[model samples]
Target chain A: MKKLQLIASMMLGLAAAGSVSADAGKDTYTKVCAVCHAGGIAAAPRYGNAADWGPRIAKGVPTLYQSALKGTPKGMPAKGGNLTLPDASVKAAVDYMVAAAGGAKAAAEPKADAKKEAKAEPKKEAKPEPKKEAAKEAAKEEAPKAAAAPAPAAVAAAPLVQEGASAADVNSFNRLLKPAGKRNLPPPEDGIHDPANDGTHALQPPLAAFGSLPKSFAGNRVNWVEAIGSGKIKPRWDRTDLTAEPIVMDMNVVREVKGSMPDVVYPHKQHTQWLDCSNCHPAIFTPQKGANQISMASILLGEKCGVCHGKVAFPVSECRLCHSKKKDLVKPATAAAR
Target chain B: MRKLLTGLRGGLFVGLVLALAAVLFVDIQDAQAEYGDVVINNHSDAATMRPVIFPHWFHRVRFACKVCHADLGFKFKAGGNDINMVKIIDGQFCGACHNGEVAWSVENCNLCHSAKPGTPTQVHESTIQKLAQPSGASQKK
Candidate 1:
């Protein structure tokens, strides 16, 4: 009886913890949605602003779900950019946002409407209401379903599997680079981001054409060059008149970690080359100096520089790239000799 | 009692050695790669024989990395950019901005043609003064 009670209590605890974490949309909103919605970047509707979300909510929950899932014409990317989120979690976030702005009535009914529409839309796996009946396997189904959702506003999310894709291939790159037959990359279209015409580069990954690529950037660069040379992948940078003037932040501040190592020169100009100011500012790193308690340990665990460096950009193994010496550090005699 | 004391002393000695080794290891394995001088000698020393010694700290204090790296397409690796006299003469690579408009022209080759001898090279006093002076945000065409 004691064992039974203990097990029952543990189950209750797990359920309560999951509900508390998942139900509070505020956490999701801050992490994923705030990147775009906090400042209404790229015309994303601001959070809790009724004027912004009400019209979007009025479109009904299914339409909102479809728009949120498939992506909207008005610059809202499918799944709000962090494609790691499960459909249920995303739905919960949307519901939270609606409740905050459009009131409780707006939150409750659209879910019913979404269920009504999902039942009518397709006869694939027939698991329409991921919220109610299928809550048992929800955790298991989270990853693959997210991956199967694929291509921001580009492709219709067909039911790739009864459950989600493998938990291993959670990131988009894995799915994109999944070994298939030779994939043909489409020509770079120019209509979505042409402020005049709304041309953008948000295209479906050439999944059919893509075979497994070398994981490393150096490896990929070699493959890319080989593909271009052999007429496999089309040239992107060459033969284009589009020249972007690189923005210089001129915020070159050297942070000295008082340790055995030399001071770290945080090159504002270097990082801002590929990323926007907001990408790192107040998110990965606070704009204020010494605010971020960065260490080699956290970086290795994929928090700071590890987020991109090891994954996509150059790895941290090339340490000399950032921990540069100051101009005054080297003696004139040493400088002249070198 | 003698055996126990000997064992304790030996253990203490081993612990001290380990601690010393750890300190030295920390010093040797400095995660931050001390930024220093870069010697660019692609064709400068090989074919034409005039190595281009790049002043890194000078350029960094003034402009961002992307200006030369991304916009100008200058590679980080020394001699990796495949820069040649022809590329610069045609107002392409180095000539794009250094066409006597944004900076000195390619005609003045000796300015960069000088080789390094391992002594730390200093930036021009005028360059430092210009950097110290606040400049407008207008981008060069």
Candidate 2:
């Protein structure tokens, strides 16, 4: 049975593609159907000519659908070569044709009334009051500007360095600043100094990284230079150009790491403004060198400093950035003692 | 000796011609770079610089890379070599971003087409006035 159906469909498909049934209703009818059907052109049947279509009307709806699906014995091309038309369209055209052929029973069935009955039968009335209540609740929920107010508070609390702070203060400054302008590139306009003006709560920059701002300087923040490169600190992403040409940092060391020559100061805030702290903190130093088992051997072998310095940032080839002093003179008297 | 002299003269003539060509080519290239995408000459005139420098870094911070590149569909490279002021004012390439919300609206011609580089503020005010004006002299006709 399935095989027979398949054969029948295939036959219909072939007939549809061909140019038979030119005058008989189906086939590629829409493009040309209106011309003749709207008016009896060249003795063609008028669209609503039930008297003329009475004989064809005796045939069933499915048969007419098939006829439209597969062209008649005339020169009409099957399916109109308008592959976009679905079987449903063909069925509607068949219905129209059948209705034209005096199949008034199918046409006058009052489909709209039936559809209305099917959709309208539930007659819902009980739950509307609850929905209205829900709407009112939603409006009430939306009334307060509470959510919007917190953003300014959040911005105020974000890590931004107040002026005249230590290296620690600089770190908190960056953290606070990071959240304030999540999407934009920093240092933000108004120059990362003023607090955001949304009125959620009183705002202040994050607390300083060091214990307290030195008494010598009451309110001045150290320049970005002192924060990162000072005290033997080495910054990260030195090679990565954030906005323009690579910056060759000049740092003055304030402290020395043990067993390590004086810590070549790394510029913290300047580099932080360019890149995030995660770019260096763990992989590069791990808060402190010995905490992560970092060694000069690993560094020289392209592990840490070797990653950028020799290749992109500035080659360790200019040795002074790290080893600050020249070799001591070997005096002749000292040589004799040796 | 005659052949050598002839060769030297031929080489000198070729060298001089090539040298002149190279100089002209370099100047032309430099001029192209100087005027690269300057559609608005008014701003250029008011500012000390002939072309108002629309540096990428200056704008990229506020707008996302994708906002101009993807949403507006600007090509990654600069100096399309064919971008025109009329097309911009009518809201084709750069106008998509420069439309009032993002940058200065390009509807006013002198805002960008100004050839003077004097006071940028004065030029900006004049451009705003021009934008506010009703289509005037031509309307009388």
Q: Candidates' lDDT values, in order?
A: 0.44, 0.34
**TM-score for candidate 1:** 0.25
Q: Model 1 Cα displacement at A109 (Å)? A: 5.1
Best model number under DockQ: 1
Could you give candidate 2's per-residue lDDT for residues A196-218 as a string of tens digits?
32210121222212223221111
Candidate 1: segments with Cα more than 4 A from true spot: A1-24, A109-338, B1-141
A266-320 in candidate 1: lDDT tens per residue? Answer: 7675555444565566667887877788887666555676554433344455566
After the best TM-score superposition of candidate 2, give how far the Cα of residue A107 lies from its true spot, in angstroms: 99
- Model 2 alpha-carbon drift over 4 Å, by segment: A1-270, A291-303, A306-318, A324-338, B1-8, B13-141
lDDT of 1: 0.44
Model 2 agreement with the true structure over B1-141: per-residue lDDT tens digits: 345435533543343344334333322221111101112333233334333324222332233333444345454332333355676777777676577864567654333332222212111111111233111111110
DockQ of each: 0.01, 0.01
Error of 1 at A118 (Å): 11
TM-score of 2: 0.19
